[model samples]
Target: MRYTFLLYSDRADSAQMTPEDWAREKEVYGAYIGALQEAGVFIDTDWLHPAETATTITRKHGEMRVQDGPFAETKETLGGFFAIDVPDLDAALAWAEKCPAAKTGRVEIRASAMGDD
Candidate 1:
């Protein structure tokens, strides 16, 4: 089965980290990614740009409306995601727990919808 892991974190708090802290965080992420690759569990992953670069589009009444930034205000914003194929949910959950952001943020794991292939 394939699962999508959505990583979320507080944009404000993440942006407040010092350069060294950021570098260390990146190193941790790199290490985790390397481990995934070595284990052959890595399918795809990517980091999203800050929320400020996001755009929200909606249809109101019959017209399309577009706005800048995220669609809604929240303490935690989606920072990235990982899509991987695993034998079962248990294996997916194990990977989620090992994610670096799992301690300070959240890693939401959802099985990919059926017939996606």
Candidate 2:
């Protein structure tokens, strides 16, 4: 099965990190990605720009509306995602738990609805 791990964190918290801390954080994520690749389960991964750069679109009453920033206001915003192929929910959960974001933020694991597309 394929699962996507959605990473969420507060941009404000990241902005407060020291340069050294940021570097270390990147190093940790690199190591984690390396592990996933070594396990041959890494499909794709990417980091998103801050939510402030996001654009939201919606349709209501047959009218299209465009708005700036995220749709919902929250302390944590989606920061990145990892797509991996694993055997089952247990495997996915195991991988998710190892993600760096899981420690400081949220890691939402979702199985692919379209299968291996």
Candidate 3:
């Protein structure tokens, strides 16, 4: 099965980290992804730019509306995601726990929707 790992973190708190810390964190995450790829389970992954760069589109009073930023303001913002194929939920959780974001933030593990693309 394939699982989606949603990484969420506080952008403000992350921005406060030292330059060295940031660089090291990036390196560590890169290595983790590389390991997943080597294992042949990595489907796709990407990091979002930032909440400030996001645009929200939704229905307002039965009319389509467009707005700036995410739908809701919260302490944690979704920063990235990893889609990996694994044996079961246990394996997916294992990988999610390995995510660096799981340390300071959160990693939401959810099975991919069942349907034809």
Candidate 1 regions off by >4 Å?
60-62, 114-117
lDDT of 2 by residue, 32-101 (tens): 9999999999999999999989999888768899999999999999999999999999999999999999
> Per-model C-alpha lDDT, please?
0.91, 0.95, 0.91
Candidate 3: which pairs clash? none
State each model's C-alpha RMSD to the native: 1.8, 1.9, 1.9
Write down the lDDT that model 3 would get. 0.91
lDDT tens digits by residue: candidate 3, 28-87:
999999989998899999999988789999786899999898889988999999999999
lDDT winner:
2
Could you give me the TM-score of model 3 versus the true structure?
0.90
What's the candidate order when arranged by decreasing lDDT? Answer: 2, 1, 3
User: How well does candidate 3 score on lDDT at residue 22?
Assistant: 78
TM-score, cand. 1: 0.90
What TM-score would every model get versus the actual structure?
0.90, 0.92, 0.90
lDDT of 1 by residue, 5-47 (tens): 9999987777779999989999999999998888888999999
Comparison by TM-score, 1 against 2, better one: 2
Model 2 CA deviation exceeding 4 Å by range: none
> Cα deviation in Å at residue 74, candidate 1?
0.4
